[model samples]
Target: MELLQLQYFLTVARLEHVTEAARSLHVTQSSLSKTIQRLEDDLGVPLFDRIGRKLRLNEFGNSFLRRAERALFELEQGKQEINDLSSPEHGTLKLAVTTASSLPNILREFRKKRPNLQFHVQMLNMQEMITLLHRGEVDFCLSSPSIYGDDINTQVVCIDPVLVAVPKGHPLAERDSISLLELRDEWFVGVKKGYGARDLVDSICESAGFTPKYVYEGDEPARLSSLVEAQIGIAFIPSTAKNSNEHIHYLKVEDHDLVREIALLSHKSRYISRAALEFRDVVVEYFGEMA
Candidate 1:
């Protein structure tokens, strides 16, 4: 029934592991267990089913979680609103992004406008980013593979065409454009399966009548350029990833509809702070200039 209990329960529910949740909450497992037990006692029903050290939300917990999340979200929004009213010029901006390629320019532009404001950035996958945005944990999220939900509002700030990157001395280096079918016999380096870019690459290759044969698979999209530079494998790099890596050559994909959309996401129902709004405008303008 207490606010602390609700926070602990929500953390536990999200993680589903007592020790992990305790570590995340910076509390002992015994204390977290006692708090959940107290919450269940007050509710007159068990909230979770224990499977060894893991906790699975039971029917009661599942049903209560939505309400608990909304309650916490509203409370956090209220706190943020108060903070914004009291000190509108400066506050921490919590943000998450799936990729960091375009972030430097965006942040540089944002900093010029609000030099005193602090930024807390988290590098997360699309789903994690969306979850944090929906929960109002972050002020905004910039992500590729745009997310959709009733509570989420998104703006497509930039659309960068995906390009095939190759080693400078490679056979295709001189080519201005190449079809996906031409890369059928080439080795590839790509982001992991779940990534937005990776999924788009896979779909594009599939449409071309073959799946990409990746020699290396990694979580970091930025590393793909280095991989190509080493002549280890070719990769699909977004236009935003344009860097002065002279050893790598970027070629357009002929007849390939591979493009990544960078989106700015915020909770539709959450109150937007002036700092967050200004940062969002900077991002939109930065991309607008690029277009």
Candidate 2:
């Protein structure tokens, strides 16, 4: 019923002990118990099974707990967004990025300009990024590699030369560059399904007249490099993906002239927060210089 009641219920359910919940909530046990009882009465169902001093969500309570937590979190997020709207310093910014490599300098520029802006960045795939944007989970996303249509507004932030990542000792590692056609049958590592980078790789492969045989699946840039370093497979990644490892060799792909376009995306119907809008300008300024 009440948010505080839901909050207290979650705490009690999580701690599984009324004493701990009451201590954490900084309230007397009797007060907390009465609050939980009142919430149960309002909902017409019990939220916890009282066993001595312990509290646990039963079958009905468990299901309610999940929904309650989600509802409570959404309410909290909405409240914070409102507070942020009221006070710039207290606002929360949510950003989803298909892959961090796509926009190499965008985030850094954001940090410089929005020194005090709080952000929650989800390392999600392309579909998730779009869904998050539509759901208002994130104000906007850093993307340019997906199949999103007219529902969202976007701006190109950067361009990155694509490269083939390989183990240091691989035959192709010593080459300064290789054509996409040259690695036709080579084993590859790729971002997981719905990842914008995976879509980019697939799009490029199709354009080059071959289907990539991805042997490993994940969206983590570091893991892909590890796969390359172990000689397990090669990966197509932005040149910036070369950092943070020494055993991997990254060779720019020639002939294809592959370049990943980094773009900022937001829902057409949604208004981006002021901080995000300002950060977008910083991104444009920092990466606009790139071809």
Candidate 3:
């Protein structure tokens, strides 16, 4: 019934350990347990199934948890809306991104216009970004390959062409464009499998009848350019990230229309602050000019 009770219950459900949940909430274990007990009594049903020192959400708990989460999310959105009304120009824009290559430019332009607005940006994988969006943890998500959900809205900001980066002296470097099938025998340098670029590359390669033979796999997409420049391996680089490195040559994929869509995503029903709206506009305009 009480907001504190709901908060405590949610934390406990997430941690599934009374001691750990109590520690996280900075309250004593006994006090936390008493609070949970009171909540169950008021509801006339037990929320969690006891399992020694660990707790699991029962069927009743599962249903209540969803409603509790939405209730808290609405309350938080109301608070944020009031704050935004008080100071439209100053607030933190919480954002998550699957790709950050274009963010520096977009954020720089936004910062120039709204100097007082703050940013909390997280570099997350596609799934993590979607999860946070649904949880109302992030105001917006800058994603590649587009995220789709019933309550999620997406706007395509840019269609970034994926190009092959090869050492200038490589045999394929003489051509302005080449098919992925031709690169089947060549070793590649790319970000790890879970990355948006990597996933796109894999799908393209699979369609082209071969998987990429990676000589080097890393977490940093930026390193792909340098690795290819060293003749370690070739890589797939987005056109937006094109650099003037003399040792590297970027080739277009002649066989496949190799491109990824960069999208701005937000929850349809969530409240977006003025600063967040401005940030979104900057993202769209920045990419719009590029297109």
Provide TM-scores for the models: 0.95, 0.66, 0.92
Tens digit per residue, CA lDDT, model 3, 167-238: 999998898999889989999988887778789989989999999999898877777788988999988999
RMSD of model 1 against the true structure? 1.4
Error of 1 at 85 (Å): 1.4
Q: Model 3: runs farther than 4 Å from truth?
A: 15-31
Top candidate when judged by TM-score against the true structure: 1
- Cα lDDT of all candidates, in order? 0.89, 0.76, 0.90
Arrange candidates by TM-score, descending: 1, 3, 2
Better of 2 and 3 by TM-score: 3
TM-score of 2: 0.66
